[model samples]
Target: MAERPVEADTEAAGIRDVQAQTRAWAALWRRSSPSSVVHVDATALSDGTGQDADDRRRSVRDALASAGAPARDRDLIDDILAEPTGAAGPCSRFLVVAEGEQLVNSVLSRPTVPGEIVAYTAVPDLLPLLLDRRGDALYLVVEAGREGGEIHVLRASQPSALRRTDVQGRADSLNKVQAGGWSHSRYQHHSEEIWKQNQTLLAAAVDGLVRELRPRFVVLAGDLRAVQLLSDEFSPGARAISSTVQTHVRAAGSSRGALDEHVAHTLGKLRKADESAAVDRLAAGDFENGAVGVGAVIHALQQGQVDTVLLDLEAIGPRTLFALAAGPWVASAPEEALGAPVLDSVPAAVALARAALVSDSRLMFVAPDRLPERAGVAAVLRWPTGPAVPGTPRWTQTP
Candidate 1:
């Protein structure tokens, strides 16, 4: 089985695009003939040695064999194993199998912690990967000179250089003392004008990039003065997302590691803050437009009201929910899921994940300890639903 490279276009999928893909995957799971689904997670360092890449590939192969997939499906596994390791950016790779056919093979640019492989009866477990890669942050690192500095735009730690220009001014040179009066004053004025020009140019470039990227957060790094000037240039929305880092950009070879570390740390902090805010809101009875628990969340998802679904990573303790095949509803008990074919013994989280994806809602995972009131799963809705009428079930029950 030789795995082909993912299409270049899919490699650039943004948040909305990935949501669409998830929806499509859910639909496929619903409609496709029943077959074993294999998901493999292979990770290799961005700068790993060749041996590391080979080891990663072999590991994927070994995982597939351990899965005990049918002999017919060996080709699918082989194909996935053949995919070049370390070919992608500092991200992990995933492959999905169904009906003994390879369904999805792609590189995910998001960093997944503790990667693993699994075989599921229905849909692949994609919620965690999608949540991790949600590229909502844009990172910008610039240098501080009157000469233009390097500008790198990172959409979720994936870097792409946006621009680099020369700054126009030079700082006061103490090495050569010129005439004490008029000459010195003239030099100072000229330097100020150059600085002003550089600032304007830098701001314009940054403003354009922000508008185009439309990231949820902006991380700024490099020289302090340059960082400030660039921060001021951002649009109001970008400013709202902006955070500054103390890491100063130095020469290429020496500064890369430090700058990258700062950006990663800042992004991690922002992610945690966002997660905390969500959890706090839920804890405060902030379901003005949302719902908590598996039942309410599933009901909300069926109505396409959910905007984001939050799950506690540690709360996925047991399989307590079931899904109706080819239907838009889920039930707390297999008996409640009447008339439709039921996918029995499904993990509640997995079922909810599929529902969330089918509705094109975002999925977020939080540490189990941080979940509000120990609520294992919840959803932030797009709009408020009317109060549940007593004794009236959301789904029709067979008498």
Candidate 2:
């Protein structure tokens, strides 16, 4: 959930800062995006009576065949089972692991898209390795032992880096100036030439690396001039989104390494702050204050008091609110309506407010508290009239 949607703050330097903008974008989407990676492993069940070892392996293979493991790994599993293990008690045993084709196919069958690596390891020892390998998604490791003739599901963990930031470098910018004298002209010409040269150098470096490494994103850390140069050259391809980031070092490789650390820390901080803010907003009576609360907002609509609606991007089910009149409301969930130009959640609310500059109705987001009270769901209302106009029951701004 978001308190407010897409907001941009332009600094004096002509730099645009979008805070909590993407949150709504994610929420306003129509479908759930899958995770980055999915890990899987295969093991055979053991029967206490050693006679059925081959049967147990066959059963395990059959189950895996239903899942999407690779033919090669499947062959490998068969080979391993056929080979004799010296430490065997009375039964036979085997384990299998695959990452490239088999794991991918298995995950694709599922509903979501995983973003990171999916590994299959026999033991947790690989946990550290998986985490090091851009570990950012869901991990499912299947541990099967020949326990009474049947295999079983063991343990699963979604090990996160606790720090994964998509790093990108940016540098281009524009500004409007009132100065138009000979001095300004000369300065502009000199500045433009210098900037162009720097851009050319950085562009070459970035383009070369991109061609070779093919990294998802690049984080450039150098002098401000050089950074901007790269931004201008790369902006055409939309290869990366650039931002003004601080780096203590200046060397290319070293700077990129330093940037990894900085970005990870920064993203962690941002995520934590976002979470805290969300919790607080939900706790506060924002829901009741605006059309945020499900019930009151709905009631307001039935009474024709709700001129507009402020929807949360993370909210669920458009069917829940179809009873309300058709007007501009912020979209909170990532689902699309059958027919509506849905704005990203919080952004939708803000846009409605801006549009109110002309229309009789206004739009705004409701606080979390009001969400439950108005909707009749289990939620707290921060205040009674937060969403209502000062002297009227109608809400003009998002709570």
Q: Which candidate is the best by lDDT?
A: 1
TM-score of every candidate: 0.72, 0.27
Error of 1 at 214 (Å): 1.2
**What is the Cα-based TM-score of model 2?**
0.27
lDDT of 1: 0.59
Determine which window of 10 residues in candidate 2 has minimal summed lDDT.
Answer: 142-151
Number of the predicted model whose TM-score against the real structure is largest: 1
User: What's the number of clashes in each of the models?
Assistant: 7, 40
Tens digits of per-residue lDDT, candidate 2, 1-399, equal: 001211232111111111122222223222221111222221233234364666755654565565555556655554454444333232212122453222211111111111222323221111112122211211111111111011011111111121121212222322223578986777676656655654554454445434533332344455555455546666343345334355523433544555456545544454445444544544455445334444444334333454444433334223322210123232333242324444333322233332221123322333343343333222222234445466764433222
lDDT of 1 by residue, 135-227 (tens): 345455545545445454445633344333343434444223366888888776676566656666766665665676555555566657666
Candidate 2 — which residues are off by over 4 angstroms? 1-192, 196-220, 228-255, 286-399
Alpha carbon deviation, residue 332, candidate 2 (Å): 24
Least accurate 10 contiguous residues by lDDT in model 1: 1-10
